[model samples]
Structure formats: structure tokens, C-alpha cells
Target: MTYTVNCSILLTELPLLERPAAAKAAGFDAVEFWWPFESSVPSDSETTAFERAITDAGVQLSGLNFNAGNMPGGDRGLVSWVGREGEFKDNIDVVAGIGERLGCTAFNALYGNRQEEFSPEEQDELAARNLAAAAEGVARIGGTVLLEPVSGAPRYPLLKAQHALDVIARVKAESGAQNIKLLADFYHLAVNGDDVAAVIEKHAKDFGHIQIADNPGRGAPGTGELPLGEWIARSRELGYDGYIGLEYKEPQETAFSWAIREHAAN
Candidate 1:
């Protein structure tokens, strides 16, 4: 039952730079995060502090996201956006740089939502190119690029396992990229009405990373209706050997107790 706390979402009780240490104090030696900086290309000092925070706390940076562009302001991602292609391209090397610095190898690229400005076909064409560049950039570090199908963002196009898989296939075939893979987030899949068991039984091994949260409420393991323990076990049984990322909403103090107790019982 190996786990990595999603510091970006989990330890919000503390400041950003302090969450890695907080995760360590909570008994997790590994952590993941969304883009930690507001800017895609952060200054040298900002980059140094983030890298040092992870290293100094003695926690592995298990996963990270490329800049998704003002998430709080209703932007989801730039990969498929109409006019932000260069920004997405610019952030590629920066993401690779940070990943290189922290020895982190997994990177998530959110597929931007469908836009009226550009046709869906146009957005997807651009996404293939951007995702290729992303894959190539991180390929230098022996990294895998992750594409997730998330819920709650209605305009965001990638919402099902097959939807993301279709894009992965296109990226590989159209752009000759092999490093791009699926980020199978169970809570999102379930919420989007995907057959979680079918995704696991068929494509569990296709995942580059796995995130979990209880469904119906998007909380920690015991706070909702998901059979999260069985899901993890079944994923393992089907050959997924990566860390199970705790990407959910809950109070910081009580967040890890559920995972700790589950681990002990197992």
C-alpha cells in the first residue's frame, strides 16, 4: 500500500513551501503537487526554493503538473487551448527543468476544454503537437507524461478513460511519442460515470500514475462510497506498481489517519 500525499491538495493548512515537510511529518516520504508556482516560467530563486523544500524534507517528488493556466480563474489547461501554444511550449522546458532538479519523472498535462473560438478538431490538432513537445522535453529525464480525465470541469474535454486513451493513441501515432500515458484517477472516473472495474481490468497497466479519492463526496477513503481499498488491491493485482496518490479534500489533521489505519489493517 505505498502512497504519496498530494501536497498541493492535502496540506493546504500550511504554506506551499512548507507542505513537503508537513507531509514528511505525517509519515509520508513522498509527495506530489500541482504546478507550485503561479508563473509557468518561475524565476531562479523561486525554482531553487521549491526544489530545496522537497530535498530538505527528504521526500521524493512523486508527481507534478505542468502549468494549467490560472485554474482558479476558470482556465483548465493550455495543451489544447487556441492561442496559448507558445506558453505551453515555453513551460515544457521549465517543467523538465524542475523534474530534473527533483528527480521527479511523472508530469500531468491537463487537456484544455472545448472552446467556441476554435473547433474541437482544431484544439485536438494543437494538443497533439504540444503533448509531443512535452513528451520529448521530459524524455531527456526518462520521464513519463500523464494525461488525466478529470470531473467537475464541464468544458474540459477529456472526461473518460477511452477519451484520454484515444488522445494517447493519436499522440503516439501522429507525433511518434511513446512516453505519454494515462493518469487513471479513480474518483474522477467514477464521478464521470465510467466503469471503474472495466478500466482496471483492461487498462490498469496502461497507467503511468494512479490517484484515488472516495466518490460521492470526494473525501478521504472512509468518507464516501468508494471501495478504495479493494480498488488499490485490484490495481496491484493487475500489475500497477506505482505509488497511490492521495488526491482528495479533507482537513489536514485527519487526512492521513484514514490511510494510516488502512495500511495497518492491510
Candidate 2:
């Protein structure tokens, strides 16, 4: 049950290229992130620099998200958007290429916010098609495509774990790709009023990756009421030995004390 720091959320005070090293300095040997660059299809130079940063940092890349549009500005995702499918498709190769270079095997594809112009059925259809394509691309590299359920964003659908799992089933059935898996993000599920324990107990076998943040404020463990440590223990008991991504928010310098404690105990 090793842990991976999420550079996109943690160590954000540092420049994007420096976060991986910062994560390593804090005792993490592996890290994950959302799309770090502004553009999904960055230039060759930009791509090379990003790869170099991770290599120089000496940390394994654990997981990455496909472009989710303007994440900070409230665009939950774009893969499922009607006019944005092309962009999502274009970014798949880029994400897969980077993941392959970094030895990353988990890729998350966010189901975009529901557009008023498009009916729910229409959006689901588009999402299925795009996710299928993404699954195919990542499968070529022996990577698993992850479906995550986000919370507190009404416009974005798939706020519940079941919703994301249903979509995973749909993508698998449609594409006949068996590498599709669930990314069980406890923070999002708790925010959406889910019984995190029950969900984990029922669906842990289907999960390929897991992320954590204490709820009520999306803070690090122990800052909130979430029993994150307990849940993690339960997950391990359920036969999940993969990386547990630390996807919380805190001051960069002090963010890893809890993880340090865990490491020491181990």
C-alpha cells in the first residue's frame, strides 16, 4: 500500500516542473498529477521539458488525467462535450505517450459537465464513444483507463461512485476493452453524500486506483472528520495493494508529515 503524491494539488506552490522533485524531497518516490500544461497538445519542446523534469526529479509517475478543459475555471471536463470530442481525442495520444515514457499505467478521463444544449442521452453517447477510443489508445500501452466521479460540481455529471462505475461498464460493453477501471476518489464520494465505507466494500475489486482527501474542506487527513486511515486499511484488506494517491490541499512544506508518520510506522 504505497502512496503517491498528487503534484497537481500538493506542492502546487512550486513551479510545475519543480513539483516532482519537491514531492521526492518529502519522502515520496512516486507522484501523480492532472494535466500540468496549459495545452493538451503541447509543443515538442514543452513535452521534452516535462519529461526531463520528472526524470531529473527521480520519482515514478503513478497516474495522470487527460485534459479536463479549464480545471481552475470550473470546466469539469471536455471529453464528453459535443464540439470538444476532437480535442479530447487529440490529447489521448499525448497523455498516453507521456504515461508510457514515465511508466504510468493509470489514466483518468473526466466526464465533462452537462451542457444545456445537449441532452443527457446525447452527452452519454458521446462520452462512451470518446472513452472507448481512449481505452483503446491506453490499452496499446498496457495502461488502464480510469473513470472518476467528482463532487460539488452540479454541472458535471458522474458525481456518484455508481455513476462512474455504470459509465465504466458502458465503455467496456461498447468498446470490448477490459482495461477500463474505476478511480475511487473518497473525497468526491463523501462530498456527494456517499457512504464511503459501503461503496468501498462493494466495489473495491473493480477499482484500479484510489485517491484521498479529508472532506468538509478537502484538506489533508486529520484536518477533517474523514476516517481516511481507516478506509485505507480497509482497502488494503480488500486486496487493493496499488498506490493510494494523496490528493489533498495543504501548505507544500508541511503537507507530508502525515505521510512521513505512516512511512515511519511501516
Root-mean-square deviation per candidate: 0.9, 1.1
Task: Give model 2's TM-score versus the native structure.
Answer: 0.97
TM-scores for all candidates? Answer: 0.98, 0.97
Clashes of each: 0, 0
Badly placed stretches (over 4 Å) of model 1 are none
Candidate 1 clash pair list: none
Regions more than 4 Å wrong, model 2: 264-266
Minimum summed lDDT over a 10-residue window in model 2 is located at 253-262
Cand. 1 Cα-lDDT: 0.92
lDDT over C-alpha atoms for residue 58 of model 2? 97
Q: Which pairs of residues have clashing backbones in candidate 2?
A: none
Candidate 2 lDDT at 119 equals 97
